[model samples]
Target: MKTALRTTTKTGTFAQALEDFKQITKVGLAVSVVFSSVAGYFLGAETIDYKVLLLLMIGGYFMVGASNAYNQIIERDLDALMKRTMNRPVPSGRMSVNTAFIIATVCAVLGIVILYMVNPKTAMFGAISIFLYTSVYTPLKTKTPLSVFVGAFPGAIPFMLGWVAATNTFGIEPGTLFMIQFFWQFPHFWAIGWLLYDDYKKAGYYMLPTGKKDSATALQVIMYTIWMIIVSVFPVTGLTGRLHLSVTGAVIVALLGVGMLYFAIRLYHEKDNAAARKLMLASVAYITFVQIVYVADKFIGGY
Candidate 1:
């Protein structure tokens, strides 16, 4: 009985630790970022190299995980004040700050080293992303609403980072990818800000463009959504280098944009949390489907 009890306790402890790690690193968000990187790689590579692709996946996850971990550490107290974040590992006392810091530091170093194996530029951008997220965006969250704009920089890099990893170049192709993601973030994050406004206020976070959930903020979301749609179809213009899109792909992407824009417009008219939540979901689907369409167009459409 004693031995069995000890084994059970050990297993329970390990399981809890794993759960804490996932919460701290935000595994879902990290995976989506990796997905974007992989899609960009597919768009740029003439022939796939499995080894480099694997490196990008691992390195990208570690970098994003490190950034999230550091952000949690910095915002532990503020996190405790917000219901949405109060259950997180550090804020809930499931994990120690020092432990989280060590994990973050290790992940950052390993991520940069692995990305360096892919290319120096990949590693450099990875480092810049971490710096921007933790150093700039994290601190600015409580200070000003413009932090959303600043946060978009690191958020936008993963898509282009994949292209750079494949081509070792920062040309119009990667630039287009960057712009698409950059513009997309405003609507995506604003919807989240709308839904979580009350919780964010508890932590003194100013996430909305207008510092309030009003028509002005909704208008900006619509405007940025329009810009995101325009950029998503820009590859059809044949100016995005090897990242060309067929007319069919462009039309499908525009349709997806319209679907997302419908949700945004609903939020504008309804001005309710439900509408904002729907817009948020639509934004996620739009970005993922748009990336799929772009990659599919390149491979299947032969454009």
Candidate 2:
């Protein structure tokens, strides 16, 4: 009975630790970012390389995880003030700042080293992303509404990072990928900002463009959505280097944009959290599907 009790306690402790790690690193968000990197890799590579692809996945996750961990560390007090964030490991007292710092440091170093194996450019961009997220974006969150725009830089890197990893070059193709994701983030994050305005205010975060959930903010969201849609279809002009899109792909992407735009318009009219939440979901679906369409157009449609 004593041995069994000890074994059970050990298992429970390990499970709790695992959960804490996931909470600190934000596993779901990290995985989704990795998905974009992988999609970009598929788009840029003339021939698939499973080894480099595997490295990209692991290295990308570590970089994003480190960024999130550091962000939580910096925002622990602010996080504790917001209901949406109070349950996170650092804010909840489930983990110490020093421990989180250690995890972030380790992940950052390991991520950079792993990415370096893919190519020096890949590792350099990974480092830049970490610095932009933790050093620049995290501190700016409570300072100004423009932080969303700043955050978009690092958020946009993974997609282009994949192209760089695959081709070992940064050119028009990767630049175009970067621009698409960069523009898309405005609507995606602003919708989230609108829905969480109350909670974010508790933490002193100014995420919305107009610093309030009003028509002006919604208009900016619509504007950015239109820009994103326009950029998404630009490849069909056959001017974006190897990242060309077929006519069919461009039409489908335009349709997806229309769907997201409809939600944005609804939020503009409704001006309610429900509408904001739907717009947020639509933005996510639109970005993911657009990436899929781009990759599919490359391989299947031979564009």
The top-ranked prediction according to lDDT is 1
Estimated TM-score per prediction? 0.99, 0.99
lDDT of 2 by residue, 1-303 (tens): 999999999999999999999989899999999999999999989899999999999999999999999999999999999999999999999999999999999999999999999999999999999999999999999999999999999999999999999999999999999999999999999989999999999989989999998999999999999999999899999898888899999999999999999999998999999999999999999989999998988889864
How far off is model 2, as Cα RMSD?
Answer: 0.8
What's the C-alpha lDDT at position 161 in model 1? 95
Clashing pairs in 1: none
